[model samples]
Target: MESEQAERFTATLEDKLQSLLTKASTLQPEEMLIRHNGLLYPALLCPEDNLRQFAKFDARPEDMCIASYPKCGFNWVNQLFRDIAAAVRKDDGQRKIILLEFSGADTHQVINSYPSPRVYGTHCHYENLPASVIEKKTKVLVVFRNPKDNAVSYYHFCQKHPLLPNSASWDEFFKEYMAGEVAWGSYFDSALIWEKHIDDEHVMIITYEELKENLIGGVQKIAEFYGFSLSVEQIENIARKGTFQAMSDNSQETHSIFGNFFFRKGVVGDWRNLFTEEQSREMDAKFEECLAGTKLGAKLKYDLYCKT
Candidate 1:
């Protein structure tokens, strides 16, 4: 009896999913929409489908790419770059920042619209990026956060986005994350791939914890990496403008273009609030088992709380 009931439940779920897909397929490209921070965005679509004609998309040597796993410090860094570029070009009468999102339906259009010396943001794994971008040797700034905190933030983000019914529970979400079933693939794998190219002088890796600990220093490092130098006053100004309080207050409708606030409690150890001792240990063991021989194993300290 239980087996029959389970089978029926599974079939019902599959039917509902197919119905949703059919409805989505019926919509025109312009009619399909994505929501960000309570606002309807018409540009959200599948990256693979949108990027199919990838050759038309190109990058210049002056282009900048800010890459990070979701729920990391992408937006915070974006805001920081905006401030730095704005400050640098204050008297030059130039718009120093360009917003490029990888998953948007009009992403290619937006990227192609910008001139040289543009800044693009993406969550694409290294192998999946456009060939032109790699060939141009665009400056890449990659940031990473502790996976525990990333998972917690991602859980809440999924709750708002409603991508999967299974993500309603933390355990289900963690299972998908651990098994590398989520979009953008495994966090460890993505980081390691980028790490291999970091020595290229065009790529730099920044950690979220370090950014929080020293905002001014972080901004200065970013400026230096991009072949620009900011005075002490300018560094201070950028740091002040990029604060969580400032970002939270200034964000038009939301703290970020993404659904979640960019300044969502920009503090380390936030994972402690979400994971119990046993859960943390279990996650750490999983990380160790999966990434045993990888460079990411050394790059990330899964036991962040214990280390401190």
Candidate 2:
């Protein structure tokens, strides 16, 4: 079982990481900071320097990158792209999906050596992406969720993930999220930055709610984006096989560095259950202030709690 394997690796990983930490040059006893491009990121499971140098990943034009803010259905969209890659490039050898921040291989090496139509997933913002990705016109799929749901999901994710910092309460975490204190920075900032590129030929933006609302249609849109065509039956089969229920049931498919909790409650509008009325209004006001004049925010009409 994938979970059992992760359980077995837990102590080993901790031990190995502890040894590495002692030898690490930049990490401190109480705080480990990875500095890149003038930003300090905690050296959790993924190091900050590695991510900083990711600008040199040397992405190819044919490559596909699934970009998202954390906890905004990233894994879900990553899985969908993986399935699409498998179906579209069936004749080619199976391609490995690279999680840019966590992968061990040098991204440049991985991108250069991998089979055609390589897919890489990242939580990196638009400005931080490798220049080649934009220069070469690499196809990019950006999936965003309602920030209200994003914050709720991220709060729970931090609680579950072993290497992430913990939050004392939802209120505390919500404040951090709004202030852009969490990883990948503010959801509104990331959304606006990526939305600016939506008009580019290489970028396709889809909200998590849209995908959840129509999986088949989402698959079709993505397939078309990648210049691939699937039959009615094939699309139907992928949709049937790739449901949240199916992914949650299959341990290997959803295997995460932390655990399987990453797949928790893959539903839209669940933020309604988590957010207080006051908290919702606070988020709405912040969203309005931050997202003003941005197409993505305007599309949502500055709403943080509404279902689309």
Candidate 3:
């Protein structure tokens, strides 16, 4: 289902990006990071110019998007969706531009030229999605994880990613995380926005815990939502191949750029080890403030995963 698609971005950095690429390559995250729309981001990627160009993209009727904040099950679910697409379409399920997170407008032009059913992923908030996605009513599969664990994985990821700044400690990172100071903006701010769309026909929302609990069922639901019909046997095979261990073993095949840093533990309870009691309380309070009684809040099952 997956084929190497890295060559598209291999050209030498464009002239306009020279400064950002230089800083992203040579400087620490502290010195290299930039802010866009109140969110801190790696200097080299998620450029405003590219994002502006992306806004003008003409989304196709068949275009479907997979979205999540960083460190949610983005890689896993994106791969799973492709596997399903391959089995259904019986073709190489290739996608251009991993996520529309680049510094050049050429990427958007290349995407416009790609074949139909162009599946793309994004970490941007729902409103920031391409305007055409809304006008065209393109379907989006949005995945969210318990933020406690999300923060832990993302904190470590920043250290490993050369372009982003590093946090001196988990405490420092957690502070920024709660403040919505990291890239992609505040998790809560976006979560609340997504909650309003819980009943939307075009949006299919799932949680990492739900996928972990029932990969086969989750896969089926995803396939059905996208109108991709897969036989029961095919769904099972896809689910088995997508288990955490299978994803970890074959990650190099799918996401070799990050090396081992693309995935760490990926366990639900790992945050228990990193968060202090005060931090846990703070997370609970934050959840209460933003997502307490909403339908999406119930979907996150915060007490079961984040509290207990």
CA lDDT, every prediction? 0.64, 0.73, 0.79
lDDT of 1 by residue, 179-272 (tens): 6656555676776677677577777888777788889999999998888878999999889988877877776433223324344676777777
Please give, for residues 13-81, the per-residue lDDT of candidate 2 as tens digits: 456556654554444423533545654355654575567557667787788799888987888877788
Off by over 4 Å in 3: 1-23, 94-97
| Deviation of model 2 at 121, angstroms | 1.3
lDDT order, best first, reads: 3, 2, 1
Could you give candidate 3's per-residue lDDT for residues 1-308 as a string of tens digits? 13433343433333434555466777755665577666666666765676666667678767768889989888889888877877876775544335766535766666666666677888877888878888888899999999999999899988887667788898999998998888887888889888888899999899999998899999999999988888999999889888888878876666645547787886888898889999999899989988999999999999899976
Q: Could you tell me how far off, in angstroms, the CA of residue 253 lies in candidate 1 after the best superposition?
A: 5.0
Model 1 alpha-carbon drift over 4 Å, by segment:
1-44, 53-56, 91-107, 162-166, 253-262, 289-308
The TM-score that candidate 1 achieves is: 0.74
Scanning candidate 2 in windows of ten residues, the lowest lDDT window is 24-33
Name the lDDT value of residue 200 in candidate 3: 90
Q: What is the TM-score of each candidate against the true structure?
A: 0.74, 0.84, 0.90
